[model samples]
Target: MSDLTFVLAGPVRHGVRLHAQALGRRTRGAPLVNIEDGALPPGPVHLHFTDRIFGRDALDAAERLAALVGTRPLSVTLHDLPQPSDGASFERRRQGYARVVAGARGVQVSSEHERGLLEQVWGACGDGAMPPVAVVPLPVDRPTRWGPPAGAQGSTDGAVVVLGFVYPGKGHAETLAAMASLSTGVPLVAVGAPSDGHEDLLTELEDEAAAQGRSFVCTGYVTDEDLERWTARAAIPVSAHTHISASGSINRWISAARRPIVTPGAYVGELHRRAPWAVTVAADLPAAIGAALHDPTSTWIREAEWDGAALPDTGTAAAMQLAAIEAIGLA
Candidate 1:
């Protein structure tokens, strides 16, 4: 049996590394490759890649890394695809995929939406039209139960927390207004840099925080440990995202703490159905946030924290898929 070698191409911080180690232990015996140094292995059965950025450096890196792999069965596991943006880097990325398919057997995308993006890639590559997508859910590893921290726990003065990267499409500005309307002294945390927002936007958020004297922790780029700490401590972990497909970390925190979330218009209904207590509202509208926050206990937030099970280790998903690949007796 040939062992699988998984690659982590870019700046995958400590938590991801720890998860990879855990996945490696769970993988029976396959070696998981950490390509943080941008080095390629000799040759593995398949080449797996994960990415979430659309920045030039990230796109260029993906192109170069794809070259190093030199045509193995490729999987471009993208967390989010740029659909609303003007910069069609997706087309450029498709060209890279074309280079892969000229020698590689096939390519796999992470989600159905992402699969659509891949089809666009193929079309841009002048590969004619592609077919339907085959999507597999990432994972639902969230703990069934959760409690407060070891040190202390208490209710907020009515602060609603936003717990992911701060991108323009993630509904930062919209949430700011909604929070402003709410009576609670709620604050928004712009965790990571999600998308391209005008510089003035950050300045606006600063002004809002300054005006209210509320606590809005704009920790630009936090370590994984800090990410977990912040997510776990918040009273309400809201995600007013409108750009991305799915938020694994946001979902994980919800599952962990049954935390109330005011999701964007896209995910509002689905989130309400799955976890009714977790509020999902239109992130573009401040009224939505105000409405959800109004009923603090409206089947939205109960009691939970992100218990480290937001996204299943894609390494595990890869292992499962790789086994199926082997079952067919093909390399």
Candidate 2:
């Protein structure tokens, strides 16, 4: 095992933090240090980083990461890296992320798509060479028998479900608009609450759904049991992220033995190429939703017991990350 200490930052429920925790669990005796403790442990450090997890904004997060890097060997697995989709903050966030990359001994991104984004945004470091970057795809848990089979007793007919935290670009609005055009009066349900600052978007969605004579249901936050139930019942599980570096939500659907309808993008395209049966890519949300509702069986895998062998699991990802960290040559 490498001598790298894994640094955990961000809220407990945050995706980056949860990923770090998952990796830490698989790393056995490797030290897991909380960044909030005000001091990082000595020696090489590994961090699962996103700007918002470290500070109020990208620039501030970069400064914080720089302070933490003082004299120690550091490597990072970047999440939610800035892209052209960031609009006004793209340049500023790119500069901040560049600073983080410059100070790192190595870098890890979850997908080749994201690595391409990193190369586009950050390019070469000051030495005219990019940091050692590795691609470690996000973990997908093995499919298990979670609840009753789909469309049993508790299923919601024709419901279009969007799982995970709702935010402005999370595709809730797009789903809402799509559902409005549909003749099916089924509700568009969000299985989780809105992201911290986007609460107003939920209200707007509700009002818009009402005005359009469609139903929209935000379950706020539900227990894991309830989430599985919702997933099992969803007629059409959809993931329509407008800006995504990597998506744990899509994997969540896969893990539940559900094939989610996703919007096309580099990451989604890569995922579809790898596991075509796991997701359906749709260029038009409304048309896709309509087609899916017309024949709900199109969103399911044929295998009775899927092992999720097509994608990396948490253990495999942790091992891949450890190998990458070891290649960085921590002293």
Best by TM-score: 2
lDDT of 2 by residue, 1-331 (tens): 5567888999887878999889888997688998888788778898988998888788899898989868789989999988887889888788888888888999999999999988987663234678999999999877666443845532335678998898878988888887777764778899898888989988899898889887789999888799888878788899998887789999989888788899998899899888887898999988898888777777776565354666899999999888898887862
Q: What lDDT would each prediction earn against the true structure? A: 0.52, 0.84
lDDT of predicted model 2: 0.84
Would you estimate the TM-scores of all the predictions? 0.72, 0.93
Where does the lowest 10-residue lDDT sum fall in candidate 1? 302-311
**Candidate 1 lDDT, 1-331, residue by residue in tens:** 4545656544554223443344445555566675555555554534444333323643564566566666454433333444435265655555544544443444444455666655665566645444323443344455444554654223445456665556566667656766765553667777655434455667777787767666566776677677666655655556666655555555556555545455544434544454454444544556554554554443234444232332344455556555544543433
Model 2 pairs whose backbones collide: none
